[model samples]
Target: MTFPSGGRVPEPYGQSSGANLADILERVLDKGLVIAGDIRINLLDIELLTIKLRLIVASVDKAKEMGIDWWETDPALSSRAHRDELARENAELRAHLAELERGRGQEDPSLERGRVSEEPS
Candidate 1:
């Protein structure tokens, strides 16, 4: 097919004689039932289908992916998971600080100076 910009676009399914455009496309995409893509697929005994479409619409940041441990693990789908995690972590840290405050008789001026944890050696 030709675009208005004079670009030749490769049609996925050809314009057919007997079948309509949708019908031809559906036959190739749905009924023809061929699996070919970047992602992996594992079918057990050929009874059930397991289609893995690796659609990287945009570039993803890996560090964020590693930090959260979601999208790969954690089956629970939550839109506010990252915010929830931050809230939970903040709560835990507050609790710890409270404990520390309780442990020491005097208030720690150093602790209040905005200390962030460094990775353990």
Candidate 2:
């Protein structure tokens, strides 16, 4: 083939074009990327199964900037969340115990005295 300037063909799409895999990954992480899709299976025109997938790729700081800090409050991923969960459970148990004590006190007036018998002998 005759070409103007030196007779050289352009590289194919798969060939290196200066942008390597690392450079592409760096750009994706810096700007953040989201991939979302849904899959549905139908049987006889009736929906049988559905799967929705969502993925986000970004640095921790970028994720935080987007208000995606679920791991911070997830009990499985955070010790602070575990402590908060325990405190909430402890408070609930204490409240339940107090309610039971109040109910028991109102159920029996003679119990306040030394009499332990529930019925006359």
Candidate 3:
């Protein structure tokens, strides 16, 4: 199609001859962009619900290039070492909690009978 200026417009989309969709996508991935928004549900000026969302779209190489590869070592991502460390930390916390409860004279009777539950920590 032709514009009022007598210049031909690119078909399908407004992309000019100097730029293509692939170039746009490559730039976006190479230089990460964050799309963040907040949604709130308010009733009579009292917010009943608030949700915040943040999204980043990038290629794996780009993500790693930006030092954003947390999933590689995250416990939830099935990293055995991280999972073990988390398990140890959780056990320590539970033991600390049990000690505190005992100090307060609140002990589970089953614990005294060597019948502790199989629950973690």
Each model's Cα RMSD: 15.9, 6.4, 10.5
Work out the TM-score per prediction. Answer: 0.29, 0.71, 0.47
In order, candidate lDDTs are 0.56, 0.88, 0.82
Per-residue lDDT of model 2, residues 7-110, tens digit only = 87877786685579779988888899999999999999999999999999998888999999999999899999999999999999999999999898787566
- lDDT (C-alpha) at residue 70 in model 1: 57
Question: Which model is ahead, 1 or 3, in terms of TM-score?
Answer: 3
Candidate of highest lDDT: 2
Which window of ten consecutive residues has the lowest lDDT sum in model 3? Answer: 112-121
- The clash count for each model shown is 0, 0, 0
Runs in model 3 deviating more than 4 A are: 1-19, 75-121
Best-performing candidate as measured by TM-score: 2
Regions of candidate 1 where Cα sits further than 4 Å from its true position? 1-13, 16-79, 106-121
Candidate 3, 23: how far from true, in Å?
A: 1.5
In model 1, the clashing pairs are none
